[model samples]
Target: MKDQITIVGNIGSDPELRRLADGTPIASFRIASHERRYDQKTSSWVDGTPSWYDVSAFRSLGEHVLASVKRGQRVIVTGALTIRRWENGERSGTAAEIEATAVGHELRFGTTVYTASAPRREEPAPPPADAPDPEPVAAGAWAAPGAETPF
Candidate 1:
């Protein structure tokens, strides 16, 4: 089973984008999610320790992340989670990571304008030289009575 998780956090650093030898692109960054609590005695809000996660996005998503995300920006990321432990000499630590499937701005903090990307397509092959021509449709032939044609 896959361990999937979603996190809302502030980006800790600019995304680093790189390409593999096969030309596949990947972007990596870190995010810190802090917990806020109300302290009754102090009568104030306090910030708890933050949980940090390293995130990576691949392919077109990576390209878009490199172009759109920045350090300190609030974002929402959803992906598969991974935890790893490592030791160097006598020191050891655990690392949390996410292989992000989706990354986007957290709109509660701000607004963003979205632009649609162009659709990808391959050129259609030319018809065979000896093929018969296609039949032409009469103007408004497919339109119902009293219905306006989109064209």
Candidate 2:
């Protein structure tokens, strides 16, 4: 997989939390972003592309998003694009969605979220206190970012 993605927009709506038939928790929300263009004549703000995306987060991630994220809050979404189709008797429409893996408050955009009540991700148990540290390795032994390993 390429792991290719686009990101970082403000939330357009409140995240709605719900469950599936199998009882997995999930939340859905929308993020709206504006695209701008340079106008040589007016040299002013010109509205370009306005995109709205439907985002879904699962399990504890979903709950955290619902509890911490709010309308007009900025967020960065990273997930592969998915197309969902639904029907209701005589009408149907397709949805473009992103299954969010990570989300963060856009502090740069004046959105602040205190995650005191949000569920934290479970961390792996640390090694026993008696364990010794491994010797440090030389540089260039690990693969660079986005580069394949020699092994």
Which prediction has the highest lDDT against the true structure?
A: 1
- Per residue, candidate 2 scores C-alpha lDDT tens digits across 91-143 of 99886678888877867757573655544556868989998996665577665
- The sequence of per-residue lDDT tens digits that candidate 1 reaches over residues 116-145 is 676566788999999999777577775654
TM-score of 1: 0.78
Please report, in order, the local distance difference test score of every candidate based on alpha carbons. 0.92, 0.79
Model 2 steric clash pairs:
none
User: What TM-score does each of the candidates earn?
Assistant: 0.78, 0.63
Quote the lDDT for 6 in model 1: 95
